[model samples]
Target: MSNRGETVNIAIFTNSYLPFSGGVPTSIKTFKNAAEKLGHTVIVFAPSYPGHKSNGKGVIRIPSVKAMTYAGFYLPVPFSTEITKAFRRYDFDIVHVQHPYLLGETGMKMARKYNIPLVFTYHTMYEQYLHYLPVAESIANPVMRKFTTSFCNHSDLVIAPSEHVKEFLSKRNIETSIKVVPTGIELRPYRKKFRKGSIKRKHRIPQASKLLIYAGRITPEKNLKFLVKCMAKIAKKDPDVMCMLIGKSAEKDHYEYDLKDIVKREGMEDRIMFIGDVPHDKLIDYYKEADLFLFASKTETQGLVILEAMAAGTPVIAVDAPAISEFINGKNGFTVPQNMLKFTAKALSMLRDKKRMKQMSSNALKTAKKHSAENMAKKLIAEFRKVKPTQDEYENMRSLKDLSEIDWSDVIKKIMR
Candidate 1:
């Protein structure tokens, strides 16, 4: 623990970090920035990206190689002596890990060695992502579930991004204390004024076009094919409506090619535009410029992009899932089942109604205000304090023998089996 009053030293371990604009990286950056503003030290231990260099202040990059299965992601070489030496220097009060494998296992070992609390955030629905593996779904799904569940059970505390995610972990028989802490958004950027039609002008989209947008990684698990189908249906009714997808494919699964093929088959290439990976600051403006924010992902734990769109005073029309249902209601946005007919109908209805759209836009902004980054940081800090070790316990832990060497490959193989 830090000598400073009410402040604690935090060590965050994540497989992914900056230069990757996925939910896990975004969530880690959001919490780290907000927590630092509230007077705490956060050191991120993440995989090294190819050309990206860390400032080497709060962030520690580990040696890694590019993953063959997943694009724009690196697999950490977990047995680095430099990382071990650097980790021993910090008197971390609690260890927070964003994933349950690779770096996550290293975090668990470090926490055990130091006798600090191991806190795991249930970020992704891991089983849904088994398509990345070469193994069959039937074989991979059970292994993934077991691997993640065991990690959660070992952790002293587990953080779920939403109440629905908490329920999910509980059902998995995760025998650890779970807390709901949705990744917070910085509201200041959303409040700033930006010129209207700037995005349309830049993209050569017509100024009078009704813009619908989706932001996140273009991957298989995101259910982007359904979104393309919905856009095709909407285009038939409204000639002026255009859908802009603002993200790049972060996986080598060729899902982007599949989506483009569908768009071509439907003969709606002009109606749908793929605007890959907008910077976070600029993405807010894109969200604000859109008339509606469309999401079709069924596997999000707590769709952070949905909240971002809401922050920009844009109403969402998302496929109904546990996390999506919590935020998207009749007041702020509409939630529909996975049915394409129902989703397109809701989207078309919202676009045609001016008065109702205005009311929902106002409601969306109000909803976003309640989820400010500061509030979520405070909640996260509270959770850290709850699991922090006592002074005597900390002292005793330090006196204990050093952690033994581990064969990571063997451990991983055992877990997979």
Candidate 2:
């Protein structure tokens, strides 16, 4: 580690970054900004996006190709000489990687080559998102687990956003020192004041109508179809209830079309509104205007969006999943099984109780306070200090596996042909 009181140089590697708006990018930005405030020198290494200008500060965007399977996401062009030389020049004290995909492997090689301590953050539950790929579900899940286990095992330490994620790594037999680090949010934005009736009036929603908001990308893993189905039941019982989805999908033509079809087929078009992606600064206003926030996704590592809603003083109604269960409960928010009947009933009950909603809103604000960015940065700095590079450890060729031994040539030929 650096001499006492000296700032440690950190290089964070990821498949995506700015000009892209999603959970991963948001997490990187949050941690990067917070870490810098604590006097740490940090730089981001991410894939370059076409037609977007990257501010040449502490970030390096490497050349990559747009992935065919996933929209607006790029896969780094393998074996980039520029990437290899860039790492050699920076000589980062620690290499932090967000995912265990292609760029991540390069990070591992560089870390080992320089004898730098490496850390991996388990950000997403890849098994739950096999539908996004063209591969067969049965084949993809086991491959994902195997790949994740290998990548995590090679790291000096692993960071899990919540205990739930740590437990998942444990279950998968990821033999690495794991730390629970919840990605903290900047609480200042949520604390700001916004025009009270702006969102409602802009959409022309009824003043008395109970506005239930869902904020995030519209995707299959988000279980938006289920939410729409539940809303259909709630609308029948209370016609004044309005469910507004406040984000757009990366593949808007695909996911958005499917969701709109559900709304029309159920004959609840007027009650369900797709208010496409609002500006991040204005997101707090949407949350503040909402009566209750609803999330059905079970694949979140920490559900940062739920915490953002809580910070905006909105109670949530979510599916009973690990990350969300950490803060959401009877006092702050409600969690129900994935059953449509039970979820619809609980949502309707919460909407009907004005006194209970007020109580839950107060509780949510308290919960949000416990997850400040300052606290998260301090915890991360402590972990960074603990990770010392062992002398002569990298010289042990047995501990570090050679990429050549894996029959990649044969596998690539068979798969590509």
Clash pairs detected, candidate 1: none
Q: Over the stretch 104-154, how does candidate 2's per-residue lDDT look in tens digits?
A: 867776787888888999999988877765567897787777777877887
Question: How far off is residue 121 in model 2, in Å?
Answer: 0.3
Question: Per-model C-alpha lDDT, please?
Answer: 0.84, 0.82
How many clashing residue pairs are found in candidate 2?
0
Assess every candidate by TM-score. 0.91, 0.91
- Shift of residue 230 alpha carbon in model 2, Å: 1.1
lDDT of 1 by residue, 48-115 (tens): 89888754569888887666667777777677776577667877888999998788978877887787
Q: State residue 270's C-alpha deviation in candidate 2, in Å.
A: 0.9
Which lDDT value does model 2 have at 272?
Answer: 92
Which consecutive 10 residues in model 1 have the weakest lDDT in total? 397-406
Consecutive 10-residue window with the lowest summed lDDT within model 2: 404-413
RMSD of 1: 4.3
